[model samples]
Target: MNIKSIILGVLFLFMSGQIALAQSTGTEREITELSKKKWEWMADKNADSLAELFHDKAKFVHMGGTWGKDREVDIIRSGGIHYKKAEIHEVMVEVMGETAILWNRITLLAVVGGNEVSNPFMVTEVYVKQNDTWKLGDLTFSKLLTRD
Candidate 1:
């Protein structure tokens, strides 16, 4: 292929990716916003809100252990691990039919066992739509070595 053709092909591919990203519709935006609010709710230790959002069989995976929705809500309510703040650096959401998956890069500051700690994590959240509402099905935090 000629140099000009190669360049044009590369540009086309790049623009196609951009268009796909730009085509994220209202549902995607809504899910993204909901994820952001979830982080805020965590920081505030608003277990009531979280309880409502979490599905009945929701699972939460942490660095320490994994548990179901009730335990997760109780932990938050009782301040077992207080999510002080989540400095969200990046977030991406993809919707597939009635399911949405969201990934977030964050620096999380938290109080665990009465000690303040900070960590970088790539958090994955999965939500399933039931009726007209979306409920969080799973939330898993994967610790990242670099702060970035």
Candidate 2:
């Protein structure tokens, strides 16, 4: 092979690799957007929409304690913990192809039994891609600050 031709072929392969890498990065951004959408539905009290985001075997560990899917549904229905508005202040996503871990800080304006409350929370959520859908595999919350 001519030296110049070989050089040109190597350059082409390198550029192709870069394109694949860029597409992979874009897919990660899409996963982060999914997390954002799910949180928005949660803040809106759209439990049905949020439900669609959860994995069937999802587990939740709240700041208070552990709870299963049934308890979570009940809490939403009974207004045990209701978010009037929840804003995500910071978000970090660690993606491993088909799975991701999301961490974020939220400023929550919540209503508990007709009383208004505010809190700063650190939340961790796991998402797994299944059948082209990202589902919440786990949710855990830690209270950074609480105001009565």
Candidate 3:
């Protein structure tokens, strides 16, 4: 290829990469905001909104056990496990194409089995973009020793 053509090709590739990076940044921000909203919904026990946000095949892992979407919604709706509040200390997100992974550190106040408890945890949330909307695919909570 001539020098001019080579230079143009390189410029085009560079611009494409820039655009992709920008899109990924935007996706990350969107996922972060969604995660915040999800916490609010969980605390409020808004099963309807949570149902819409969670994928059909979504799974949840807690200190006790792992379960599917329906069981999780049932627990929230029935007040078997209530997420009273979450004090988010930090959050970080990574977007990979259509999937995003979010890491959150927080102190959580929850009521389980008629008793209220507080604990610190590292929460991992995985979301997948399907049909232009992000849906929760997996969530796992790792209990932390210190409640700093």
Best by TM-score: 3
Best-fitting candidate, measured by lDDT? 3
Per-residue C-alpha lDDT of model 1 across residues 61-116, encoded as one tens digit per residue: 99999999999999999999999999999988888889999999999999999999
Candidate 2, lDDT over the whole model:
0.79
**Worst 10 contiguous positions by lDDT, candidate 1:** 18-27
Give every collision pair in model 3: none
Better of 1 and 2 by lDDT: 1
Model 1 misplaced regions, further than 4 Å: 1-24
Global lDDT of each candidate: 0.94, 0.79, 0.95
Q: On residues 3-116, what C-alpha lDDT tens digit does candidate 2 reach at each position?
A: 999999999999999997787677668767987787676666778777777888888887678876666766775678786776778888877878888887887788877889
Cα-based RMSD of the predictions, in order?
6.1, 3.1, 1.4
Q: Model 3 compared with the native: what TM-score?
A: 0.92
TM-score of every candidate relative to the true structure: 0.83, 0.80, 0.92
Candidate 1: residue 61 lDDT (0-100): 96
Quote model 2's TM-score: 0.80
Q: Rank candidates, TM-score, best first.
A: 3, 1, 2
